[model samples]
Target: MLAEAAKSQFSRDHSDHLALVRAYEGWKKAEEESAVYDYCWKNFLSIQSLRAIDSLRKEFFSLLKDTGLIDGNPSICNSEGNDANLTRAVICYGMYPGICSVVHNERSFSLKTMEDGQVLLYSNSENARETKIPYPWLVFNEKIKVNSVFLRDSTACSDSTLILFGGSISKGDTDGHLKMLGGYLEFFMKPDVAEIYQTLKKELDELIQNKLLNPKVDMQAHRELLSAIRLLVSEDGCDGRFVFGHQILRPLEISALSTKPSLFSRTESGPGGDNSKSQLQTILTRAGYTVPMYKTKQLKNNKFQTTVEFNETQIMGQPCSNKKSAEKDAAAEAIQWLKGGAKESHEQVNHMSKLLKKSKKDHL
Candidate 1:
């Protein structure tokens, strides 16, 4: 039926094509005695339909053989002879960026796309009314919004598919987490996953560049990369969620920095060290200011917490896993204080420091 439909100009309409494909898929999986099987057989038993079906079956088998996905004739190849994982991966390769996440404690799903927000499964989907969904992730063909968003031709996919085929990934706020789609989506996984993902991205990029440089070159290596991507997409167990990174919901904006001299310059040791306290102290000393002394408190959890009073009117607090880290955080806060109109000159800093010291002494 599919072959006949493909050859007939009348059956080449989009609706007819979609219906034929869906029916064929349903027929392949239907039981011989089932209503679905009967429906497909009755609808497609015409001489043209039968001829078309035969041609399609032959083409499908030839493709499987060419891809080395099958060793024998497809007509005799049973379901047991197929590699389900490889087949799903191949499907994912074409349906990438069509990934969706299941809603938490909800019956619906959400896609990470600009056009669609929440999507419902098509009534004909096997997962449409299932009580317990088999997979948390799904790869869908397309979404149409009528009264609400509807996912067409959806298929359940593993977590690996997202990692492999999803859009660009960037570091998340905390360690061992990654943000995707310019921070629209987030994933928490093993740190190794991040490392592996970076490596894979690099490899894929190089292959693309090579292909671009020599369009006619044998693409065996490129094909291998694609296969690797498919394999990665079949892995499981990476939790994901939709989130806005840095409180900026839209894409980030880039701007040139002001030409003004920075309050401090990074030294060889870097910003993560215990130098923040010393940096603050040096700035204060050079300004000839003695303000209220900064205070550091140790939390019950053993983490260091520090509070720095930038002026009589402004204060900043920071907490870190260790005393050194806490000091670094406080130092950064102090720089922002200066930049926010506290004082840029040494004389101004010294005056502020003196006022702070007197305030502390008076309180004592």
Candidate 2:
């Protein structure tokens, strides 16, 4: 009803009515399109529309001042480059009614969402576009291409802490964060790492269909399968080292055959080690989720059995937090109490002491 009232109050004679409606529809569409891809192209349609609609919306809101529907003073929204970028990150990671931590990185930069409003920002330009000044409310940044990404809902946490770790700008980590908890976060155990395995199986089937491998041994088939995955998921964010979704590969070691194998050898060899997803699953397992690799079972052929484990500390990071805000609040409370002259006392002690003395005298 409130939305309807807001819509109804829009004026027909206003030159921007058409533009405002167009902008609203465009914003809605861009949001929907934005959710479709874990990673999007440099010039996707949604990016373009976001730029357009954002600019127009700012313009339309400005026009509101002349008409007096609102006070000449209009409410303003603040924007920070990092916050806007983090918002993009969350949407890329997705918020599918569950606890998730979204992670992303480039060749030299890495980042993750610690809190709810952080977004993923991308630019395909050789040098990323940088904006310094604040714009009119309608002004929107152009659609940018994402290099890499990860989005995950978190586990059921008693306390909301979006821990961040292992990202140093010098070592090339660009971490951002957000948190939601209790009633705000809904936990679901559906579509865990098992889905990733299923996806791999489908791709393997496709390779078989394309005559890329002999079914009996499948060495070449396996290689082809691995190559396909490397191509499809190798972008900065696509790799799972930071997100820790699943550990399908082994770490790179520099021995004669001790070197880390590519992602292909890792998944086919078994589900642990350098495989990033496997590590992620291990992290989830330690956190007490019933991940399948951690729930070991006998293999039918009996050639080999796999068990996955990771040191708790090796995981290195947790989600982000609102603790900064919480700290500020605590400090404020302390200050307020000090100003109000509140105090704690032991008044009951005086009466208890007198009673004790009388009782002692009677006993004597």
TM-score of each: 0.43, 0.19
Q: In candidate 1, how many Å is residue 107 off?
A: 7.4
Per residue, candidate 2 scores C-alpha lDDT tens digits across 1-364 of: 4543333332121112232444355455656787423212322234555567679867876675444333344333222222322332222223223223222111122122323233333332111221311110011122223453322111111110111110111111111211123212111112443334345545654654554333234344477656544333322232222222222223222132212221122122112333434433433332223432221233344322222323211111111134332222222222122112232112222221222222211110
Worst 10 residues of 1 by lDDT: 244-253
Candidate number with greatest TM-score: 1
Q: Each prediction's Cα RMSD? A: 18.0, 28.4
lDDT, candidate 1, equals 0.50
The lDDT leader among the candidates is: 1
Clashes counted in candidate 1 amount to 17
Which portions of model 1 show Cα errors greater than 4 Å?
A: 1-39, 42-81, 106-114, 204-235, 238-364
